[model samples]
Target: MANPQKPPTAASKSSALASGKLGQIIRLLQRAKGATIDDLTEVTGWQAHSVRGAISGQLRKRHGLAVSATPDASRGLVYRLPKAGGTR
Candidate 1:
């Protein structure tokens, strides 16, 4: 049997936040010019509110990234990196 108390592996962590998965979502939105909560939700398979929380809380607060959304466009808003990379 596996060790229950062992920490998660790097592979697991990467999978959870892989570019192909979450990174791709962010990249697509950035490259798309912008995207709405709905667009992020569709691509990430997350709910709109969850996407909002991740954008606001996780991306903005935690990662020092920015994601914006508006009501008019099909994609909604855009995401951009800070002029200087954030505090990691």
Candidate 2:
């Protein structure tokens, strides 16, 4: 008989984030131009509110990341992570 598969552990779940939508969003924000809520929502198939919540609750609070927002004529609000040693 075949062996039963094991459930995902904490390590596995965390590792999955490295390649999941959240990871992709992080990479997008790390770019020079950063990204907007529409961009994140389109990429992740999440609503605008969910994207904001993820940025605030997950990336900012849980991960201790500093995310900033600035006005953009074309994209509404652009979000990005400030450079190391830089103020948010």
Candidate 3:
């Protein structure tokens, strides 16, 4: 017989954002100015690649957030969530 699997609970999902570096990244990106890799690394102390991976793998895939990257004249690359009223 196959083993049964437990479904994901709300606590499990919420726990992912409860604390640590990933949570800090999400909060930083949630701001109006969003955040750059430099900003994320400054806060989380992770490498540039790790920051990108967390945004792509955890925030985008696992949390289902709409993460977009746009170029800035001064900041180079900035990552942010799309505006709520704008078209996806």
Candidate 4:
């Protein structure tokens, strides 16, 4: 009989996400000013949609990160993680 594979835990997924392009995006989001789609695309060499997907699919969905986007005067949408010790 074949063995079943367990789904990844939040810690493992977070560790995986904390490297490479995803990490880059996280860092940008952690910044006080946050980052726009253009900024994420520029850093990761990905299309705007791809960046959005990474945020929505990978960060928010997979990692269960409460990534939020707020409107900015200079930037259209600034995406970022919520402040530590802050409520979502």
The number of the candidate with the highest lDDT is 4
Instruction: Please give each candidate's TM-score.
Output: 0.55, 0.73, 0.78, 0.78
Each prediction's RMSD to truth? 5.1, 4.5, 3.7, 2.8
| Cα lDDT of model 4 by residue, 1-88, tens digit | 9999999997887678788999999989888888999999999999999999999998889878899899998789898896657775
The segments of candidate 2 whose C-alpha lies over 4 angstroms from its true place after superposition are 1-15, 83-88
Cα lDDT of all candidates, in order? 0.61, 0.87, 0.86, 0.88
* lDDT measured at residue 39 in model 1 versus the true structure, 0 to 100: 61
Count of backbone collisions within predicted model 4: 0
**Candidate 1: tens digits of C-alpha lDDT, residues 12-87:** 7656654554675566556534565656777889887777777777667865566555455543455544333443
Best by TM-score: 4
Task: Rate residue 36 of model 4 by lDDT.
Answer: 96
Estimate, for each residue in 8-69, the C-alpha lDDT of model 3 and write its tens digit: 79888777675788778877887789899999999999999999999999889988889989
Question: Taking the tens digit of each residue's C-alpha lDDT, what string does model 2 give over 7-86?
Answer: 99968866775678888788788888999998999899999999999999998998788888999998799999865566
Task: Tell me the spans in candidate 3 whose CA falls farther than 4 Å from its real position.
Answer: 1-8, 82-88
Give residue 59's error in model 1 in angstroms. Answer: 0.6
Clash pairs (backbone) in predicted model 1: 19-24, 35-75, 35-77, 36-75
Better of 1 and 4 by lDDT: 4
Provide the lowest-lDDT 10-residue window in model 3.
79-88
